[model samples]
Target chain A: MPILWLFLIVLAIAAAGYVIGRSRAVASVGGDHRKMHSLASFYGSNVAIKVFVPAFLFTIAWLLVQPIVVNATVSDMIPEAAIADNSSRGLVMAEVRRIADGLDSAVAAGGMSADFARTPQTDLDDVTQRIKDAGGVVTSDITAPVLNAAQRYRAMNGTGNFIMSGLAILIALGGAWWGIRESHADFRARNTVETSIRALLIGAASIAILTTLGIVLSLIFNTIEFFRLYPAADFFFGTNWAPSFSGRGGSSDLGVLPLLWGTFYISIVALAVAVPIGLFAAIYLSEYASKRVRSVAKPLLEVLAGIPTIVYGLFALLTVGPLLLEIFGKDGLGWMQAGTAVMTAGLVMGIMLIPFVSSLSDDIINAVPQALRDGSYGLGATQSETIKQVVLPAALPGIVGAILLAASRAIGETMIVVLGAGAAARLSLNPFEAMTTVTAKIVSQLTGDADFASPEALVAFALGMTLFVITLALNVLALYIVRKYREQYE
Target chain B: MMKDNADERIGVDAMDIKFAAKDVQVYYADNHAIKDVSVDILDKTVTAFIGPSGCGKSTFLRSLNRMNDTIPICRVEGDIRLDGQDINAPEVDPVQLRAKVGMVFQKPNPFPKSIYDNVAYGPRIHGLARGKAELDEIVEKSLRRAAIWDEVKDRLDAAGTGLSGGQQQRLCIARAVATEPEVLLMDEPCSALDPIATAQVEELIDELRQSYSVIIVTHSMQQAARVSQKTAFFHLGNLVEYGDTTDIFTNPRDTRTESYITGRIG
Candidate 1:
């Protein structure tokens, strides 16, 4: 049976349980709802939950476990003599699984018989041709041992699925039976349902947290593997970043310093452009703008944030880069060699981050207690003087946190740098010179005909780990500052 | 001796009027907050505006320094003169006027700066001090005058917000006085303080009467009697009575004032 159909069957069982449980509860109270321990709907929900949750959980567990067990049993059936040199057991297992799927599909399409698919006497070429004709993928001609393994794999999977379907329905029926039996007036259905809901919510929240943990762990393992191939000291401190992609054995300099420098320099430039403009914009919006102007202008300013960074990358590549090139390119001031440089990327990234800094700082400024402003104005200070001396100082910690968050954003930015800043990692001071960031290089290292085992390719994970650490530290610091500010005010 | 002197000074025409309002009407977004109120505020005296909550005493006091100008919906009509010059005139800047008429709010709001910096803020913005030495001298003098110098002199670098409720209010008073304003408007400055702090602030207010014309808005009728030489009772946005403190308490001319003072009606 299809999993969707199984799911619907379970749902139908739960629906029946709901109706039976509600009516039973009501009958136990002699049809008087006032005498029931909980509402009729609560009893219904309790039965539905009992019928659905455990059964669905069992179904999912079965679905996950069945393939692993089938693969292990079927791969053991293939003799070691049939395995070729320079290929892994895991690879053979992948082929076996694919061939098994193909045979199943071929049988389903009426090009082959179920008896022939399960039997060992079928011709290998004819079976492979029929599988291919049935629109199933086959990497190579099937050997006798492999064909026998594929047949066993299909047999085991079919039996496993059949058992899973039977077990799931049995569990659903058992749960529904137990729930209906417990549907008396004294049963605390509401509390039981409430506890289940709380557990469900906790399960949801933990899944999100666990997924993040899993991603971090994966990155950590890969980074460790990369460091095993490449020297840690060289990766961390070496100034050069030239990765020779000729082959794995070739000497490659995977220094992170130049890339780190580029990241920082571009981030500094971005911050330099963003901080003043963004802060000023925030001040104008929060302090000076009238309600009419603010209602329109605040959202319009935030609209800049809503524009995807990829679109900004395009704008940087097509418009801002060329515009800057016209002023500082070789034909003009001779300061820039091409349109794509650190300054081009930095400028566009700054524009992209303006809304980030402005919106956050605006909220921070607005959060500064009106009492402080009142105290300043009461002292005969001008509006500008009041904001400068009182409001800004009170809002300073929060604004710094906002700026740091924007800084992290600038450092993590990839698309803008890839399109605007050229893909050369150079340790130069000139803003107009081409340089690349860690994220940009991470992109470049992974997306070509590079060997996965090679340091050049695995270095993407290392770069990712490094970038993650830096941004994570920045986020922690930002949160710390913001929290400290909140404590001070409240 | 101070009480005898205050009584002797009352009703004396020799005293100069610091602020004179003529038929001042204040409307906040079509809500008539202050209605046709007029009173003469004398120099070198503490005058109290006493009323129930939402009775417009604070509104009338805020109108004195034009603090109401900060509220976009607030509109002030008629003439209010500071030292015989119309403060509401187009030529008069509210900023400069605020320097001459400093205010302490109902709550103790100290700037999020060091104690030294908080006192120096007003003088620095107004350019009252020519140098750091002069600025320091002014801060010390103002703090000393506000009676907070001794408590905070050792830790002037400490954040002003770190002070206790009463100390912060006194620090605010010092900050206001640092500008050397001719008039000081205190809107229930000791309301947030305990009895001890209130007494301390009341004593400071009485002392402040020596240098500045002080107008205070208070909820407590006893606080008005304790602090002010002159008392104005406002009822329902109307100035029901204005007289010497002793007469306002002991012998009120209006039935409403009598009822309010005797706790019959608010």
Candidate 2:
């Protein structure tokens, strides 16, 4: 196999390079005690690399081009009567291979058939991989001319393979010899390798920028496709959101108002749940907790954050949804539909965000200069007064940025909403009522059977663009607030 | 330098045991910061503490009103008494102590508010003024006392952070003064100011002696000589010398005090 030949050639190259390098190292001493350039091994490796790299590349390129070229040429030689307009070249190639196998099988059995179509198989040194239809000749009564052509063709094929592979190995050995000769003490191989590595790093750095550009452009083009089927005005302003591409005729209207409402409602609920709890917890951890308490509590809360969103989604669906339905189901206080309402998802999401808000705020609070706190305390202010008047105000900007980031995450969240916030898309005032958001609708419209070109499917892109713009705007605002905040202390 | 005790005591007011700290030792997380510091702060005169850094000048300054109690790991042992009542007594509150003895910090720490609110913060918290007009009077009086009333009277609503560095420090001084404390503690208040601001603040401190007992911790010996009536020399947490400012600066009896004042050593 090609793998085995490459391995053997590499070993021989290493040995030759080593011997040549060792000789060069010893000879350059010139009867004096001091040595000349590089070690023998370095010379040998240098020559080996010189010989192997180019020849290996050439052999690989030839191997690829030769097979395709031979296949195409032989494909033309296939029976023209058997081919048709609808027939494929792949099938034709398969037939040629089968025919060659049959010829080989017949020749090995010493029984050449009588249906031989090949008469001058070897005389014309065709470079095609095809063999003269060997199965067509009869064993004892095969035509003389046909037998000679078959043998000659086989000989030519064998000779071509030997030369191609032999040259590949020879070039590899020559490269090893040259690598050894060129090896010297001053070669700076490290710098050469590092320069190439630096180029690779630059290549990697541009990928992040390009990927962002790619996502934006892809969204814009796809959104344009969606607008072709649905009017932009209706998509933006419509109140209902029921997308039925199957044309069943009873489906409700599809608009963004319901999803927007749901996103706002859930986010409000999540903020309601997250802000007080996160802030209070952060205060306790950063200000009140002893070192021992902090050591234990910090990592435990981080573990809560590490639980995957999918697991939270499953918990909402399997546990909370049914439990709430039982408590509120048209019987007991029927004000609630199920536990997996806006409150449920928001509360769970808030719990997940506790560590994020706390850790970020904690760092910002700690970073607030120690002098400010001392100044407040020196003024005879109590611990509570100092924190309320001095530290929190100083840390407010970073906290606002953190809250904005959390809000974006809330808006973009999908799994928990999909499982808990039911498929209903309505402008309802009740938090207990089922609702859907932009991300949930995106998952729904994209997954079900719908044409990619359809307005319904393309609606996801428009939603995506909206989400992107909102998050970007929020990011700018948060950064502005944080920067202004720092300017006060700096 | 050539002053007797009676001449030195010319400006000194009769003391009624206003505030006294006895053998107070402070530790921060088991690291001994101040060891066995004892001092008395009189009613209506400027008392200056001069020392090399880490000699616990500021640490002793914080102990007069129990400000070190705010720091969780900063432990204090020994009694600090105010008006014959122990401040470390179980029922006595640190907040009340701070309200009665306000402080100016080393750096200008004006709150991120309008110049008016920065001055009015302490009064607003303590509910000192009943209405807007009364609060205005308090603000004007505090700013005037700090010698920044004319510079900022026109733009009271401008952000405190918008002021120049010296002005910001004066604003912080006005903030502490607004609380109407009987004793004012200034911890290296001029360390972050220019020489002009330092001179202005020293003039203000001289004027302040008429109303409040001012204990100042300063690095500048010239400042201590100019603004203080009484001087306490601290060396390695010990109150090594205490007497009239002129006497201590000119003819210190202690060898350590002589070496420090003469610039032979710190």
Candidate 3:
């Protein structure tokens, strides 16, 4: 049976249990709700939880385990000689599973008979033709041992699914019976229901944390593997960033220094453009702007954040890069060589981050108590003087945290650098020079047909891990600064 | 209304009036907050305005320094003169007016700076001192005048917000006095403080009457009788009675004033 159908059947059983348990409890209380320990809905939910939780858990576990067990048994059935020269056991097993599914479809499509599909001694070419006629992809001709293994794999999977459905239904029925038996007036249904809800909430919270841990662990393992192939010292300190494919048999120098330098240079340029413009915009919006102006202007400024980064990348590549080139290219100041440079990407990225910095800083500035402003104004200070001396100082730590967050966003940006900053890894001080960041290189290295085990591809994970650590450190520092500043006022 | 001889009423000369207002009216949006209040406040004396909550005493006090100008919907009308000059004239600047008339709010609101810096803020902004030594001298004088110098003298570098409730209120008073204003407007300055702090602030206010004209708004009738020489009683935005504190508390003027002082009505 399909998993969706099985899910629906379990839901139907639980719904039935809910109705029966609610009615039984009411009947046991002689239609007087005051005699019951909990409300009628609580009793219904308790029965539903019992009927659904264990049965669904069992079904999920069986679904996960059946394939692994079936694959192992079927893989053992095929002899070693049956494996092709270019293929391993894993690949052949994949082929067997595909054929097994194809056979089921072929039988359904009436292109092959069920009896012929179950038989192991049939002609391989005839079976392949029938599968093809039924619109199944057959890479090559099937051998006798492979055909037998596919047949056995199919049979075992069918039996496993059949038994799974039966056992799941049995558990649901047993849960229903137990729930009805406990549906007396004195049963503590609300307590059981509340505890189950708390468990469910904890389970949800842990899933999010566990997923983050899993991603970090995977990155760690891959990064360790990369280190074994390439020296950690060279990867860390070397200035060159050149990755030669394994097929070329040439040594590759995969240094992270040039990438880190590029990342920092671009981020600094971006922050230089963003901080003053963003901060001043926030100050004006929060302090000087009228209520009607602010109501319209705040959301309009936030619209900049809602624009996609990829769209910004296109804007850089098509408009901003060329605009910068016209001013500083050979025809003008002779500083830039091409449209794609660190300056181009950095400028566009800064424009993208305006709303991010302004929105956060505006909120922080607005959070500064009105009492402070009143004190300054009461002492005959002008509005500008009051904001400059009192308001800005109080909001400085929070603004710094906002700037750090924007810096992290800048460092991790990929699409803008890919389109605006040319893919040349070099350490230079010139803003007009073409440069590439770690994130852009990661994207380049992971795409295409590079072997996953090669140092070239594995280096992406190392870059990712390094970027993760840097951003994580930045975020922690920002949070610490914000928290320390908050303690002063509260 | 009956007009009595000024010397017979309070034994004070009439020429000592520092602030004279005629037919003052204040509005917040469409709501009239203060209605046709006319009074003369004497210099070198503490005057108190006693009223129930929302009776417009604070509104009248804030208009003295033009603090009501900060609120978008608040509007004030009529003639108010300080030292025989119309303060509401177009040529007069509110900033300079505020420097001449400093205010302390109901709640203690110290700037988030060091105690020295908090006291130095007003003088620094108004260019009252020409050098750092002069600024420091001004800070010390102001803090001493506010009567919190001995308690915080050793910790001038400490954050002003770190002080206790009473100390913070005193620090705010010091900050207000740093500009060396001629008049001080205190709007319920002791409401947020305990009794000890209130008593301390009241003593400071009594001492402040030696040099500057002081106006205070209060809820406690006994507080008015304690710290003020002249008292004005307000009920429902109307000035019900204005006289010496002893006569207002003892003798009957309006039936409403008598009822309020006798705890029959507020």
Candidate 4:
């Protein structure tokens, strides 16, 4: 049976358990529910939890562990002579699994009897032809040892699935019987059900945390592998970033300094454009704008944040790049060489980040207590002087946190740099010069046709690890500052 | 000895009027908060406005310094003069008027700065000190006048907000006094202080009466009687009676004032 059908069977058993458990609890106290330890729904939920949880857990575990066990046993059955010199054991296992599936389909289509297909003396050509006629793909002519391994793979999988279905249903039935037996007036069904629900929620939360850990572990291992192939010191300190793609073990100078410099320079330019404009906009929105104007304008300003970064990337490429090129190109200032330069991406990314800084800074500024402003005004200070000396000082730490978050966002931006900042890794102070960031280069390295095990391709993981560590540190610092600021007033 | 001296000064300085108001009315968005009220505030004395909550005593006091102008919907009408100059005139800026007439709020609100900086804020903004030494002298004088010098003199560089509630209020008083204002308006200044702090602040107020005219609004009738020389009783936005503190407590002229003092119809 299919896994979906088995899942529905377990649910049906649990549903029956719910009805029986509720009725049994009531009947135990002569149909007076007031004598029960818990409510009627609680009793029903307890029974359903018992019947569904364990059976579902078992089914999942069987599905995860069966393939490995079966593959290990069946591959051992194949002789060493069947193994080819060029292909790996994993590749042969994949072919074996595919041929087994094909044979299963051929038998299910009535092209051959099961016993006849399993006979060792049956013609391989005949079985292959029958598999092809049954609409199964055959990559090569069937060999004797591969044919025997495929048959064993099919037989083991069939037995494993059958056993899994039977055991899951048996567990469900046993849980239902035990639940109904315990469904008396004195049973603490409510507490048990509540505990189960709490466990379920904890399980959900841990899944997210565990997934993040898994991603970090994968990045760490790949980074270690890359370091083993390429010297760590050279990768970190070297200035040149030229990757030769002729083949593996070629002369490739993979340095990270130029990329780091480009990332920092572009981020500086972006923050220069974003911080002042965004901070002033936040001040106006929070402090000066009237109620009616604020209600209309705040959301309209936030609409800038909702625009996709990809759309901003296109704008940087098509519009801002050309505009800056005209002003600073040979005709205007003779500083820029082309449309794609650090200035173009930085300016456009700053526009993209305006709403980010404004929205967060606005909230932080608004969090400042009104009594401070009142105290300042009571001392005969003007409104502007009060804001400059008193209000802004109180909100400075939180605003710094917001700016750091925006800085991280600018550093990790990929599409904007790819489209606007040309794919040339260089270290220069001129904003008009084209430069590439770490994220943009990561995309280029992985999408190329290099071998997966080569250092040039594995270098993407190292770049990813570096970028992740930097952003993570920035986020932690930002959160720390924001939390410390919150403790001041409350 | 101080009470007799103050009484003798009141008799000798009967013509020293510091503030005069005529038929003043206040409105907050069409809600009449203060009715027609007129009073003369004499210099070198403490006058107390005593009333129940929401009786417009604080509202009327705020109008004296044009602090009510900060609220968008608050409006004040009629003429109010400080030192014989019409403060409502367009030629007189509210900022200058406020510097001339300072205020202390009910709660202790101090700036998040050093204690010395808190005391020097007013003098610094008004350009009363030409040098750092002069600014330091002004800070010491103000803190001493507020009667909190010894407790905080050693920690002048400490954060003003780190002080106790009473100390913070005294720091605010010092801040206000550093400007050398001719009048001080206090709105329920002792409401948030304990009995010990209240007595201390009352003593400071009595000493302050020797130099500047002080007006205080209080909810406590006994507090008003203790700290003030003149007492005004307001009920439902109306000033029912005004007289010497002894007479107002013993021989009130209005039945409303009598009922309020006797705790009958507040």
Candidate 5:
């Protein structure tokens, strides 16, 4: 309640400072030097900001300290015996308060003895009768101290409120005065204001770095815990990835090699489907196609990118799987299964990321200055020859960057893998067979009702850590390649 | 539909005379950039197009090889007869036209490839070389013709972009030469090069007149006087005067040409 009052007083002071500054400026509105920058409101705002900001900070600081100081002083007044138990003191204080309330009611009801009332009674008699009625006896000795402490509490509360609000007003007034005094020539207001803003920007940037560090550390620590019982060699080298070791009768098999194989196999398939098609589309747009063809084709290509990955996952699961199976299923070639497999998901993912790769590669290709294209054309080279021999080579670094970025996204992809890719993790060479990726396993292992303290749950973190490291390296490499590309052109 | 004037052009060029454009109109989107323009370029001669910026000299140069067609919104309506042959025929491929009429830009633009590869690109695309030895000889001969062979002969495997500015421009010329084109066009080729490189390129241009007719666009009036046999003065997208280099400089036919030549106006 006192903090609310102090806040009001501080606000009033700030408003007064703004009015005063604006009026002072208004005096010079007509003919005084004709040199004031910004506007009267901006000056008023500056004054108000100076008056309010420091006072608010100090008030919040004092509020934090007040409770701690009051608690220490109040706790010190308690007897050492009550402090020793620590637990019994709360119950004892409640009992004492109940008796005091009963005594006050008795005095109001005119049921107390005149002699007892005359002495400004200790309320001991009323408590005795009330305790007897309840069939218990908590002595009246704690009652006297309860009355004494309540009286001291109200006084301390008043003093704290007075001092805190008074300090807030004084600080605000002092700030306004200082600001008015410093309003002279050669005072760099913009520099002071921008320095504060620079500090804020730095604070915002540090948060991104810190968040990445925190995630890495968490993955590392949990993965370490997972490695305590399960050996790292078994996790990385063994083929079968059955986490249910208890069901296997002492056979514990959890391997990442199969998952890693699945990840690479799918990524390779995705790249195969994407690169030639994407690069050709990019070249056509950047080199040969007219503006009309490009305008129609470019956004149509980007529509595939706009459809969410989960939709692509559904398409893979419901459509592509069935379609593939019909062609290679029991009814036809009988080489593939009825459910999702590596090819179905990878093809869909490749379709989804085609624009992701192509648009970026297109920009890079287009950015390879028109001068280079002119140089090629002047030499009698055909359009395709020019793009293949000159433009693509110039744009190679940026294309590599775009591909690496897409690959990193693919490696860390969760929704599509979780929905479309199969659950079984086995080291296999066939693209027709169903297989699982690292992301699919992570989602499965983490969301299931496994005990948090066990190695099974902790292994998710280990997988997470491995996934983080791989993607981080891919991103850093992508950044390095992009920077080199920029340096070449710029 | 395109018109074929190759038959007419062959007979006229066999006579060793000048090609002429009667009237040319250039439009960009809907804005008329160049009004009815006419000029003549003589055989075995260096013709200079001199004007202030945006006077459409470069536009006229690009029109010679249908380079204007590369720009989507640009529209050209004109009669440009090269040796009496109307160049814009329906059966005519701009690629072939560009091959026969090569160009060097205002800025030196080298391919980001090896010097050998850069020079060999045009020959490879046009299938002008029969074998490795032939292609090598062609590449070397073109480089020697551009006058950068001694400096870059040993570094043929090095990236073309790694060369100095003057060498890069010569490398561009070599690349153009590898296609075995007939007429060479230069648009402010010395603007981005140093004085020494400019002298070297100018000297090379004089030697090139033995086989290929050359047209140059220059901002410097002194350059036109120094390197050209004939000069065409343009102002506000109009060809104001075109005559012998001596007559254009010493006694211009038009007032605008006179003011520009005398440094009164650009």
Candidate 6:
């Protein structure tokens, strides 16, 4: 059965369970709901959840496991001699799986009979021609060993799916039966439902956490593989960043220093621009602006954060870059060679991060209790004096945390750096020069038709892992500072 | 009813009026929060404003120092003179006016700084100290005056927020006194404190009265009787009576004041 149809069938069973479970509880209490331990809907939902949740979980597990089991059993049927030269067993297994699908579709399209598809004596060329006429993708003419493997693959999948459907439905019915039998006046349906809901929420939360863990694990493994092909010391300490793209076995200079420096330099420039402007804007909004002005200005400032970084990248490329180049490039001071440079990307990225810093700092500044301001004013301190002496000091840790978080964002940002900062892994102090960051390099390294076994392609994972570690550390520090500050006032 | 003999009870010639508010009507947006109210707060005396919640006692006290100016919706009409000078005059800077009339809030609001910095904040802002040494002297003197010198004299570098509740309140009082204001307004300064802290603050208020005109707004009638030399009872945004504290408590006057003091209605 199709998975969707199976889902609908289970849903229908759960729906039936709901009605029967509610009526069972009502009948147990002589049709008076007040005598029951929980509301009538609670009883109904309890049975529905029991019937649906486990059966759906089982269906998903069966779907995921059946393919692996069928693939393992069928791939063994193709003998080693049937495999072609310079190709892998895994590749031949892929061909067998595709042939299995094609044969199934050929039978379905009525171009071949089911008995002919199952029989081993059927002409191989005739089966291949029928599959091609049925518009199935086949790499080459079907051979006997591949055909036999495809047949076995199809049969096992069909039987596994049939068993899965039967078992899932049986479990749903069994759960519904138990749920209805337990539906009595004294049964605590609400408590059971509460526990299930709690488990559901926990499951949802763990999905997010587990996905993060999965990403980290994947990055770690690929990075380890990249290191195995390249010297770790050279990758970390080498000043050069020339990745030679000469096929699978080429020597590449995958140094991280130049990229790290560029990332730091751009981030520093961005922070230098963002921190003061964002902090001043936050202070004005939180302390000096009238209520009418604040209500309008705050959202207007926050709108900057809503603009996509890609749009900012384009702005840097087409607007700010040229504007700066006209003054500092060859047309003017002759200090810069082109519009795309570190200064262009850094400035535009700063503009992108202003709202991020300002919005967060504004909230942190506002969180400084009004009583502290009142106390300062009552001491004859002017507004600015109070803010400088009391408010800013009180909100210092949180503001620093906000700035650090923005720094992490600047480090991880890709589009702006890719477009505005020219992708040249150069170690230069001059702001007008072109440079690239870890994220931009990762994108450039992964986009082409490069062999994955080479250090050139696998280095992207290492770069990604580096970026992730830096950002994660920054985030952890920011959270620590913000949390410590909160405990001060709370 | 007793005659309006406020002049006879305190011997008016000996006491100097520090603040005099005449026909002070306050409105918060459209709400007439404080009706036509007038009172003379004397110098070097503890005067307490006693009333139920939202009776405009704190409002009237805040108006004395123009602290009500912070609220955007709040408006004050009429004259509040400090030592015969109209404090609301356009040329009179509220910041300078606040320097002469410092306040302590209902809750202890110690700045998130060291004990020394918390006390030195006002003095530094007002430029009252000539140098670091003089600023240190002012801090020490203020802490001594607020009666928290002995307990916190050792941990001057420690954060004021880490102090106990009573200690923090006294530190706030010290912060207020550091400015050397002529009049000190306390809005229920002991409300967030325990009885022990309350007694400590009440004692500080009495000591502070020797140098400053102390105006306190409190909810406890017994607190008014215990700490104040002059008492004003407000009811429904109106000042029911203002006179010597002893007379307001012991003598028959307005029936509303009687009902409030005797706990019949608040």
Q: Please tell me which predicted candidate would have the highest DockQ against the true structure.
A: 6
iRMSD for each candidate structure, in the order shown: 0.7, 1.6, 1.0, 1.2, 1.1, 0.5
Looking at model 2, residue A329 earns an lDDT score of: 59
Q: Write the per-residue lDDT of candidate 2 for residues B141-172, one digit (tens) a residue.
A: 99999999999999999989899888988998
Runs in model 5 with CA error above 4 Å? A1-186, A245-252, B1-15
Q: Tens digit of lDDT per residue, candidate 6, span A105-188?
A: 999999989998888945778888899988888998788898899889989988888888889999999989989988888999
What ranges in model 3 sit over 4 Å off?
A110-116, A246-250, B1-13, B264-266
**Stretch of 10 with least lDDT, candidate 4 chain A:** A115-124
Q: Tens-digit lDDT track for model 1 on A1-490?
A: 7888899999999999999999999999899999999999889888999899999999989888988888888878888988989777888888888999899889999998989888886578999999999999998778888888888888898888889999999999999998999999999999999999899999999999999999999999999999999999999999999998885744899999999999998899899999999999999999999989999999999999999889999998999999999999877898999989999999999998899999999999999888888888888988999999998999999999999999999999999999999999999999999999999999999997868899999999999999999999999999998888676765
Stretch of 10 with least lDDT, candidate 6 chain B: B1-10
Clashing pairs in 1: none
Q: Where is model 6 more than 4 Å wrong at Cα?
A: A25-35, A40-43, A80-92, A120-135, A247-250, B1-9, B12-15
Say which prediction, candidate 5 or candidate 6, comes out ahead on TM-score: 6
lDDT of 5 at A403: 93
Ranking by TM-score: 3, 6, 1, 4, 5, 2
Each candidate: what lDDT? 0.91, 0.76, 0.90, 0.89, 0.78, 0.91
lDDT of 5 at B131: 100
TM-score of chain B of each: 0.97, 0.95, 0.95, 0.97, 0.93, 0.95
- Best-to-worst ranking by DockQ: 6, 1, 3, 5, 4, 2
Docking class of 6: high
Off by over 4 Å in 4: A23-37, A77-92, A95-151, A177-188, B1-14, B253-256, B264-266
* CAPRI quality of model 2: acceptable
lDDT for each residue of candidate 4 in A1-490, tens digit (9 for 90 to 100): 8899999999999999999999999999999989999998788888888999999999999999999899999889888878788877777788888889888888899988898667674588988899899888888788888888998898899899999999999999999998988899999999999899899999999999999999999999999999999999988998988888786745888899999989988888899999998999999998888879989999999999998888989999999999998999999999999999999999999998999899999998898887777677777877777788778878888999999999999999999999989999988899999999999999999995868799999998999999999999999999999887676654
Off by over 4 Å in 2: A1-202, A248-253, A326-328, A448-450, B1-16
TM-score for the first chain of model 6?
Answer: 0.94
lDDT of 4: 0.89
Which scores better on DockQ, 3 or 6? 6
